[model samples]
Target: MSDPTFSVRPLDEDTWPAFAQLVEANNGVWGGCWCMGFHVRLKGRTAAQNRAEKQERVREGRTHASLVLDGDQCLGWCQFGSPAELPEVKSRRLYEKGLTKLPEWRITCFFTGKGLRRRGVADAALGGALTEIAREGGGLVEGYPEETDDRAVSGSFLHTGPMAAFENHGFTRTRPISPHRWVVTRTVSPT
Candidate 1:
């Protein structure tokens, strides 16, 4: 087992490739669709188009982003920015309603490489995200996680971390849009 100590830092050119690779590595679960389900719905677009659009957003997001790492390996990332900065999140029907009522950061998808699971990586990632947001003087950080009994009991989600990891990082349940979806938040600053 690797040491539990790792650093979290702002996403940059040097760090993005590893993040993209990890996302691609999980193509079956997160690939094909461009990670755009929470951002936009491409009614008739081809998979390539979806991938391109998502990659474009990701390229932009890297400059204004947060990521977790164990040495040089990108362990996880939390994609957050202004609603305008993130068209996908801003345009999503489920996320559009209560936005801008406060300044917030969104915790998007998380990915960990094989053999890296069940080792507190998610908690470390979330902690890094919170601290970085605080350093940047951002407002609250938000997360939308699937609510599931099996996850609550076991704290696993294929390669994705479970909701309890967010909760363990001080995120409280704000609302549940459906039995499987929830909105949670942890306010980092009053502004």
Candidate 2:
């Protein structure tokens, strides 16, 4: 099949609602996160509450990029920013095991609409991010892709990305922070 064409632009107030809907649709398996599981502390609340909390958090602050759209419809969401912008990631218990250094650009989250899975939307989104980063000509783009020995968790569960997907875009495994989490980096050179 031919690849679908879509554009990945920074999130704007105009597109945030569609992005939220896309995120909610994935919550059935992603567990009501709205892709906020990593960004905000859940504080032992229910998934619905966590979702509500994240929505509030989104309102209170600015995000680097939060919307991915195909024409007028939102198809995916990718949360990224400079390492300093993502203060919450610095305190995640999962990140403390072996991550002593910080990345230049942190890819904290991702979500694709229900109908758009297994499509090339993610690669397109990553490419768009790279284009923007390259244009700025600063910062190393980084990702935390899931690594799994368990067969059940290997598929679909690697929602952020699988090693192959990142590698496919020139990201290399810089370190294995945990058994199922990796520090992946790819330096972008502007053309």
Candidate 3:
């Protein structure tokens, strides 16, 4: 169960400060990624560049996320966006090979704050994302999560989230995109 003390908010101009604080405190989240890995390639970009680009996207309403908050502080986030909004997904070749049609929304990654792991932050964020999606007139939502039943995986590498997290939100396993990563999906009705 998610922590009841946590509240969810959409990542927008009003909530960018909290989100930026969390990312900044966590060293730009995954070595200065700033949670932009799923949105665009970060090979030549510096951390500052990534931060600027992410902020620009948010300002332009091109980025989407559910920011999990404890009071005014952001604890984590679940990023979801349309295909055009976030096109750089992991295992793209394999995912494309099996793609019959594009989903309306894709949950690309999650970020939990320092000293706050394994405490249901991810679950809360995922739930929040679903609710936000519904408000946007929901449809097919997809997530790429790793199956962790057979092995121990580090939280850092589970940016897409665990399969159990998706299952908890009523998502069903669709197919495997990698050895441990599977494409999971669910349909959320508009709220």
Candidate 4:
């Protein structure tokens, strides 16, 4: 899973097949999340319904992601969006309490294939997301990564990724939204 041959690419309609395959391999990511947890209004909707809604978003170019791929197969991805596109903050009150200014884009979640976990896939995905953000006229890019040393927590709980990855990409910790999650940010090279 630590293959250095993999490369990063932005998700688009053309690459949807590979992305769908990866999602299928992971069983919809976090038990049928379909990477829609942060984007949808999740009240009363079933997972299947949310998945369908997310699929529509992706089809409409509303959903954005940077994917780590081996050839045509997507191994992992980092989800990103404008604050308006994904306003479901993990600790909404805490985030609002510490809020200084809103970021232009947010790094919401990450998903790597089952066997691909711990293989630097999330790192690649975050990096890819940053690159794409820069390409689209860079702005403040925010991220939420857990700050924990406990391996007892299932990796599934780490969909936001680890703080080290954010730091590696020059994201500075701005505030702690929760005991386990921190809001980190970096400015992408803007045109």
TM-score of each: 0.71, 0.75, 0.98, 0.93
* Candidate 1 segments exceeding 4 Å error: 1-3, 33-39, 42-65, 87-103, 151-161
Each candidate's lDDT (Cα)? 0.61, 0.66, 0.94, 0.86
Q: Give the TM-score of candidate 3.
A: 0.98
Arranged by TM-score, best first = 3, 4, 2, 1
Model 4, range 4-104, lDDT digits (tens) per residue? 88889888877788888888777777677788888865667776876677778878999899989999879899999999899887888999998989999
- In terms of TM-score, the best-performing candidate is 3
Model 1 RMSD vs true structure: 4.3
Query: lDDT at 173 for candidate 3?
Result: 93
Better of 2 and 3 by TM-score: 3
Q: Per-residue CA lDDT of candidate 3, range 89-108, in tens?
A: 89989999999989999999
Better of 1 and 3 by lDDT: 3
lDDT by residue for model 2 (22-117), tens: 666666336665555566565665777865755565676545554557777887756777766665652257666666767677876666666677
lDDT of 1 by residue, 1-191 (tens): 22466777766557767666666676623446544544556567666776676667666763344566777777665555554554454224655564545446777655565666666666776666677777778686777776666644332332223577777888887766445666688888622
User: Where does candidate 4 clash, by residue pair?
Assistant: none
Decreasing lDDT order of the candidates: 3, 4, 2, 1
